[model samples]
Target: MKKWREYERLVSALTAEEYDKEYTVIPNARIKGFISQRKRQLDVLVEYRFNSDLNRRIIFDAKDRKRPVDIKEVEAFEGLMKDVGARRGFLICSNGYTKSALRRAQEHIVIKLLSSDQIDDISIGSWDMCRSDSCGDGLIMWDLTPGIIIDGTVYIQATGKCDSCGKFHIWCWSCGNRICIDYESELQCSCKGPWFWLTSIEPDCDEIGEQYESHYLILVLGNGNYHIMDRRPI
Candidate 1:
């Protein structure tokens, strides 16, 4: 349990430090009063800072328990919310909470019950380029393998087939690579380089880890470079 709490603290500290441009997080802060005179040590303290005038405390309690938390646990967390004047309180438990506990939290707008599974799903991963034409330069082809490292980052690629066009597409699990299957047949890509054609995409989400897949349209926009365009997923 101590090790789990330490891990949670480490994760919280890393996240806060990484996103310091957007938020201000204070882990393990000791406070007194507001309701009780005893000093309360918060597991992780966070503040959502958007602008000069927008900021509020978001408190967290990391519990490394394996049993389902009961309604009484929810009530206790709510008490801390009222005492600390925090707009939100996250009770992150490892084994999840009971239905009655969730029902109890419904009455408190600031109280939220989150299991480790749910918290782990909270990711800030973003696409490099959302627009098809704005992908720009810095394009490179991958060997199409699980846990492939590009620029020192791990990436996983998967394949998919469109039902309407019967074309296969590839989706990278890490870097989000779009698979292409429009083999130019008798014509060349005009880039004067090897085709580097990609084929064989799987559809199952369990395969690629992403629900979306797209078709790529490779173009040669001068300078001996290839621009990959995509019909992205919505």
Candidate 2:
């Protein structure tokens, strides 16, 4: 599929730009698995240095399909991550993913489930102060302005980790309803809005150099758990 190859290239370009020159980003990489001792084809591969000069690898797989990625594919990706011995793996889909796949991703902390619609050139700004009572001076790192539609209502979302405590913060750009969580958890606005899941991938490169975050918005559906909609990044 030529279209799928183009989509994978776009994903590789976006990921490479995210890290800039700090890391080595390779497109269409074939890596040898430790356990299988076989070369596995990856859509994108990232190599970076961790603390104490330890080298770490990150892999990305782009899925282009008419329907959302299912739970079985997510499980296979997890196995690939382990086989490749990557510190983190990003599974980016053109459509979205099912609710069961999202739940499966939560079980593994290293697997990042993402929706690759388009790469946005968002300006990084402090949208609001941290809500943590203990850390009053800390600010939310980046402001994501894309609005997610739910139940015929458009709600702008802003989510980032606190600078001091590293707690994940989710906020509504319209009503200022926000909440802080320990990690990527489903959130509901106090304004009685619908529940939604926000997935973020922040590579552990803060100490070594620059760090970038990739976020995905998953819309909760009332029909069934077989399908879930993800916001298209603008």
Candidate 3:
């Protein structure tokens, strides 16, 4: 597992280097499954806005096996793609793929197979500063994805745990705006548009029937201001 972790790290670094600007590349992303309504752990999830009304989501899975990946593995991954409603999926393998696997991947338009050779060397460095005012110069590891739309514009947002203070650091990727929820709970865009924070609680049960909270942030733009609402299940 340690070796696999290293391989995944390499893929994540390369992916972030290539797609961080235009797309939100999240490593070790945990997303809820639309079908099962359960949390599914993904190796990486890439999110972007195709247009004003459409959001495109892509998933990446890394396999580090000695032998080539076979058709069964490809099929299993395809199921995951459907469960998550991903537009497309990339399966990165260290040892390549079997002929059957290649054929199966070809059969599915959403599936793409890649060898580790496809990813080049990348230097993973800290990109943004933590928004925490007290935690000066604290670096925030961003996992930005598509957030609320405001006035015909889609805003990319990320919230990372501050390394210095262990507080949530929020940021806007499009305009270099940053805020720390520990010190401040309000969010505003770079356009000087104020964003209101709202919360909603929803009750939910896990796969084992254990109750949990579901959280979502809804952003609405009107009257030259933006409203952000969070749905948290209790």
Best by lDDT: 2
Segments in model 2 whose C-alpha atoms lie over 4 Å from true places: 49-55, 107-234
Q: Which stretches of candidate 3 lie over 4 Å from their true place?
A: 20-22, 49-55, 107-120, 125-140, 143-184, 187-234
**Which numbered prediction scores highest in TM-score against the true structure?**
3
Q: Mind giving the per-residue lDDT tens digits that candidate 3 earns over 64-156?
A: 778778889889898888877776788888777877788888644333444555534433355456665677644444555456676677666
Q: What is the lDDT of residue 165 in candidate 2?
A: 50
For model 2, what is the C-alpha lDDT against the true structure? 0.57
**Better structure of 2 and 3 per TM-score:** 3
State the lDDT at 230 in candidate 1: 23
Decreasing lDDT order of the candidates: 2, 3, 1
Better of 1 and 2 by lDDT: 2
Candidate with the larger TM-score of 1 and 2: 2
User: What is the Cα-based TM-score of model 3?
Assistant: 0.55
In order, the Cα lDDT scores of the candidates are 0.46, 0.57, 0.57
TM-score of each: 0.42, 0.46, 0.55
